[model samples]
Target: MSKEYNVAILGATGAVGTRMIQQLEQSTIPVKSLKLLASSRSAGKQLQFKGQPITVEEATPDSFAGIDLVLSSAGGSVSKKLLPEAVKRGAVCVDNTSAFRMEPDVPLVVPEVNEAALKNHHGIVANPNCSTIQMVVALEPIRKAFGLKQVIVSTYQAASGAGQSALNELKQEAQDYLDGKDIQDDAEILPTKGDKKHYPLAFNLLPQIDVFEDNGYTHEEWKMIHETKKIMLGDMNAKYIKVTATCVRVPVPIAHGETVYFTVDDPSVTVDQLREALKGAPGVVLQDNPAHQVYPQPLNAVGKRDTFVGRLRADEENPGSFNMWVVADNLLKGAAWNTVENAECLVKDNLI
Candidate 1:
């Protein structure tokens, strides 16, 4: 007999939240009960799990009463307000927003990269940014083998990472464009909802994914830079790794693709050795066979949980530095699956 636990999803009606529900259907965790939670507007909505209809309830402090685990994707503000309450109610939370990720005490985890960090969680475990999650998943094995010194990544992010509205708008814009209508009017809630200006993501690439900081880096880019160091190299060794990222919103609907350039500590490490290391890395799939023109692509990665790596090569001019292409379903391994994987780790380690 398997041990069973009661689990709740904090943002049940949203994009990643829905994916969490779907992933749970296929999850290895033994769930005795599933509670769907969302804002009051989404309450009374019925969602299915294992062919059973589950009603989404309005999330509040009391919603966590009998819950053993909380997978939160209800946005940062919601997590900021409710996660502590969930913890107070004896529920461990795996937060998928930026709310508690940088909180020193909260463990920002990508189970493939930092499962050990879960042990340090007081009650909340943070799921990293979508782009950062997939990037680190592909880079962790390299970092572990050659000792990553610096990382520079440029991301072609899917509109799905923004929100369901953004994705819909992208489709709307494309259709409107093909119909000879004004595509500009279809733009509303992206590259971010908080930004004053909105851009059409259908036939255009917005260089910014979130509001820009004073330093000119968008919040999304900064999340990758800071979160990567935190997840890949914990506090003591964080300073050893230098990370920079440029996040862009592309027309793609589901998966995110990245071109990553990284420098390792050892210059002697060759391309063949790196390829072999990635081939055996857990949660990573190596698709780098240039002869056949095979490589990881966003279309191929959609719906998959593994990080796909390809285009592996050593930078001839910069010894110790290599470039690779990384792709994954932004909603799966990047968000929902990662959240579930963290919960699975906790259960496996008997932390729950």
Candidate 2:
């Protein structure tokens, strides 16, 4: 029999956390035990795993005792505080937060794009942002076939990217709007829960995702820009890849859609060539059929783990440039599934 490792899930009650549970249940890692860690308010809750009830515990510095693997999607602050504790207790952690992503020792990974990075982890691995995950999954195959030069992306992000409350708020706001009630007056989450200003996301689009930084880009946009380079090119080579993004919060409840325009280093790369590159790419489903009007959409992508890519075309204005549409479940491939995948890689590589 293969070695069975003890696994613990940090933030086991949140949106991504719950999905992490689902993904783990479907993973190949041999599990000797499963531990669910949440905050005190949610401590007594019992969540089902493989038809068994696992009691949620309040996470502390000592929650990681005897755990061999840790999958974390707790907020960044919680991760910043608790992940090191988990690491100190001898567990390999795959974190689904921004806290440690840019750290010198941490590997910010998308398994399809940079699975080998997991071998370099110093106890913790970082999962890229949801939007960045889908883009890179689609782009990596093309990059490998041709050569990537630059990327400019505009995202149609779903409400779930903001979290469960925001998803609930989107539903309420949509209903309020449909019933001719005031949405703006009760709006509090979309754009960002931490930001001062709030806006209705129903039947409308907010041009911002996270709070703005000094550079005039929202933090979410900044993540897509920097995280892409890190995942595609490593810290030393990341500066060579140019990436720019505009992230927006849309009314959709799950999955994220991106319109990406990229210039390949090889000027002769054709649209059909790009389509062929992605058709068999790992974790990528090629849905590009312009004649049949078949392409990736958020509704089709929801609840699925694969990143869907379509709308392949060459830029008429720029000979070496190409464009594509990418979509995936922001909560799954973007967060939970990626986190679980990293853990599987760690096990496969004997890094854990």
How much does each candidate deviate from the true structure in C-alpha RMSD? 1.1, 1.0
TM-score to true structure, per model: 0.98, 0.98
Q: List the residue pairs that clash in candidate 2.
A: none
Error of 1 at 25 (Å): 1.2
Model 2 scores worst on lDDT over the 10 consecutive residues at 232-241
Model 2, C-alpha of 233: deviation from truth (Å): 1.0
Candidate 1: list runs displaced more than 4 Å: none
Per-candidate Cα lDDT values, in order, are 0.92, 0.92
lDDT of 2 at 95: 94
Segments of candidate 2 deviating more than 4 angstroms: none
Residue 37, model 2, lDDT: 99
Model 1 Cα lDDT, one tens digit per residue, 135-192? 9999999988889998899999999998899889999999999999988868899879
